[model samples]
Target: MQVSPVDDSLEQTELRGPRARTRKLMLDTAIALMQKGQTPSISDVAEAAQVSRATAYRYFPSQAALVHAVVDAGLGPILEWHSDSNDAEVRVQDLLKTSMPRILEFEATFKAALKLSLEQWAERQAGTFGDEPPFKRGHRVEMLQKAIAPLKHTLTEFQFQRLAKSLSLVYGLELLLVLKDMWGLEFEETQDIAAWTAGALVRTAIAEAGV
Candidate 1:
């Protein structure tokens, strides 16, 4: 649940005193449970935080909302990342190098979020999704676009968007999960591979653009 600037401002305005504390408690509890490899529900978080279900529901109306909040909390510094460099390749590399370690740290939590996302997708396909809010999962789109922003002038809009989408393949939880879990690579190896792949994609896109 990557919030817009307006939503961020509204959230800051609303979260105060007991409200903030309660929300923090729920979020922290969810993160802990997720770290332990449990995809906890709102009820689970409320129980673990020793708050009533009603209070928990008031904070997180559905499981998707709860998981989205947990994902946002886990994102931390990656969500606020910026680069002073104007070079797209360098920016993409820096973004990968900076974000991968944090992603690894919260690997379990992110995997739980992925599981919930898949579950929601399956339920929706089967027409059993009911009224649950869909778990939105495109924070990488914005981040990747920002990472390769310098290329906008060099590449056409289609090329720029395509490059950003290509970079997304080697970023975030999916990259870590694939390179580490499937290939048995260590953290350093995974990070190096992701950064190399991202840089290669950017360079390839620029070359193809004749820039």
Candidate 2:
């Protein structure tokens, strides 16, 4: 006399399996193209992933969304990293050790994504494009704040923010572009230099704070 209920949401998810796979394929294809220093449109991704343009549009809705998805994926471990240690220096070092290699691995891909954001900024400044939503960048500020949380009371609010911002300058994809690309340093050398620079920043900031 009793019957079990079939969940409608579960049923829909079961039916959407292939669609989910296709979406992932398109995203992966987009990242692959970007890794090769190419900025691919959704249509290009669809072609590369063997999906239809209509379906690709259904997944991403716009070029900005598609690129954002790829760039988000490119962030990898750095975006979700957390540290249990309370030592600010140790936390900063661990963050750098975990993130730099991943960033270096996808150097071209991240740079291409950065290039798109920069180009959009320029176009917006020129008043040639104003309707579309802007591409959102990373969460470096929050992460940096967490890394240096122990220094909050030691330093002034402005000093805390300034130190974090300075550390961030040598932390992300810019580290690759600056030390490796601009200075012509080798990979290992670049990592060493970044670590040294970030350590010095932390030391000087703390010293000046009298902590």
Candidate 3:
């Protein structure tokens, strides 16, 4: 398991044993509150988690940090996804099949994070958010690139990148919402379409690249 940029945001510092557990407890508590239709503050999470405010603050400096942590947690396998195959297309197929469903499973948690992000965006736009870091969302780039590593020599760098970027259209919480909510498809149908669409994109890229 190589070090990922996500690990830094997911951990405030090098956490150990009991401290790691305590941090996880706060994140879990925040997630539970979000699931129940409430956006909890850092103080709120501290109280519900029965941890000291100072300790909770130590783990998560702000509500934004807490929510970002939950969203990243909701991403599950995607953050640390691994595949042994050197076949680019197969790796992507497996990655999407494994991760898309997990994305839907915690849709609400991700959606809440998105909502907070949007609210933060509006505040920033209105010059009220101060110097807070923009609520960043992407954690898929490295894994996606790795999934298609075998294609590196098969296509121009630009073409390979385009294929990987196209995959975002078929994965992630937004895609699930578009399929299940907008298209009104069943879960199986939604996943099937996503997987199918992903395959089509990969095949098309390969074909276009004459590989």
Q: What is the TM-score of each candidate against the true structure?
A: 0.93, 0.88, 0.86
lDDT per residue, candidate 2, 125-194, as tens digits?
8988767677767667777888888888889999999999999987888888888989999989988988
Name the better of 1 and 3 by lDDT.
1
State candidate 2's TM-score. Answer: 0.88
Q: Which run of 10 residues does model 3 get worst, by summed lDDT?
A: 1-10
Model 1 bad stretches (over 4 Å): 1-16
CA lDDT scores, all candidates in order: 0.90, 0.85, 0.83
At residue 201, candidate 1 shows an lDDT of 89
Q: What is the alpha-carbon lDDT of model 3 when measured against the actual structure?
A: 0.83
lDDT digits (tens) for residues 93-124 of candidate 1:
88988898898899999999899889989998
RMSD in Å for all candidates: 2.3, 6.3, 3.8
Clash list (residue pairs), candidate 1: none
Number of backbone clashes in candidate 2: 0
What's model 1's lDDT at 34?
97
